[model samples]
Target: MPSRQWPNILITGTPGTGKTTHAAQLVEALQSSPSTSSATWEHVNVGDFVKEKGCHSGFNEEWQSWDVDEDKLLDELELVQQAGAKVIDWHTCDLFPERWIDLVLVLRCDHSQLWARLEKRGYQLNKIQENNEAEIMEVVLNDARESYAAEIVVEMQSEKPEDMEQNIERIVSWVQAWRADYGG
Candidate 1:
């Protein structure tokens, strides 16, 4: 199959917005459905991938996260992108080039729900506040829209289990549609 026939999806949002959960569930669902084609889809956790691939330049003490070198990360992602049908899970969206992504799903959550989730994860007070503020300001959503075309960027709320299920089903349908359109 041509590379463009397989869609590359990016699931991005603030830390507690359930991006990884959704991406994993979606991959499982797609894999189980025999009708969804034999082409395998990969869930690429950008954080873990960065560490495993040594794409970061250094560590950030304040955030307790890697100081990712964007260029290096992109270089590493090139090979993964070529594999196609990747569910790229990450917190930041705009760093990736738009042409490489077919869809950008920016998961969102209620501020209170997000705060509770972050607190449950044992995030520092300042870190929680920073994430809450970013969510409230629609930082990820805005960045996704700016980085990709409006038609391809979707902002969906993920505060409940039902929402997660619905989102997964919706994305499955989208993948099927994409396959039909692109001759996957």
Candidate 2:
């Protein structure tokens, strides 16, 4: 694919990792950071997008989440990507083809923190155990590494307020560099 006017950022991780929060902040940061070029940035939360676009087959009782139809979801997002910049927030990353993404941020949190966050969210025992194990095993991180080129994938800690602020600053700088290199 030809270079886009702006980048598509995929924020992925195990469920309690603050992917949504980071994506939202990134979009806002990009918009207000006084860049040289004009841009249209957005946060695309895949779980919500799937349900809104009818790209999910049904709800998964076991996981208490939607059973997304991958093909249908991807088909819709292909059009969305054509528009401009996007910060896609999801628990899975490998499903996205590398060509469609400019950056892959795999957010991670400590297992104890993750467990507490999941519990706070009212996740059931099975769901909580599944996510906690995934975090411990670095499941999302491995998936992101295997799917995208190493240079484009960044692993970041999302455990505290300071970490989030630092992440946003770092990513914004990266975006500025990207825009400069690619004529955004």
Candidate 3:
């Protein structure tokens, strides 16, 4: 893969596992950090990106969500991935090309907490149950592992606020180390 100024990290997990929360905070943290001040980091929410880039085929009534055209979405991501300073947030991970991502953090929440989060969001019963099952099965975690190098994929705990803080600290250090090893 051609080198870039910074890393492209993907924060993925089943719904209600704080993937968006982690992605947003990571960008904010990276942007403010002195070590990575030379790079501009952004939180790219895939769902919104799909709509913005016209990568969706249509809404799915059964799922009550937009049907993502994976090929179109991947095509739209080519340039953005090359830029290489984004925190991409999404539930699905394996579909992204292996080379586009440098790190994959799969946030996992306790089943109870996951349920509460989904419920608090007023998710439909079926949607909540489906996500709960997916989390229990470790679907996203497995997909991330299969999609990226073992060293690049991390399973993170997302049950408490402190976990998020710790993740940011570790990732910041990782960024600095990456800079040491790779020219920006």
Off by over 4 Å in 2: none
lDDT of each: 0.90, 0.89, 0.89
Local accuracy of candidate 1 as per-residue lDDT tens digits, 37-154: 5878789999999999999888988987899988999999988898678999999998987778988999999999999999999999999999999999999998988888899999
| Residues 7-119 of candidate 3: C-alpha lDDT, one tens digit per residue | 88999999989989888898888899988977888889998998899898899877778999998998889888888888999999999888888889999999988999999
Return the TM-score for each candidate structure. Answer: 0.96, 0.96, 0.96
The alpha-carbon lDDT assigned to residue 180 of candidate 1 equals: 89
lDDT of 2 by residue, 58-140 (tens): 88998898888999999999999876588899999999888899989999899999999999999999999999999999999
Model 2: ten consecutive residues of lowest lDDT: 31-40
C-alpha RMSD for every candidate? 1.5, 1.3, 1.1
Error of 2 at 101 (Å): 0.3
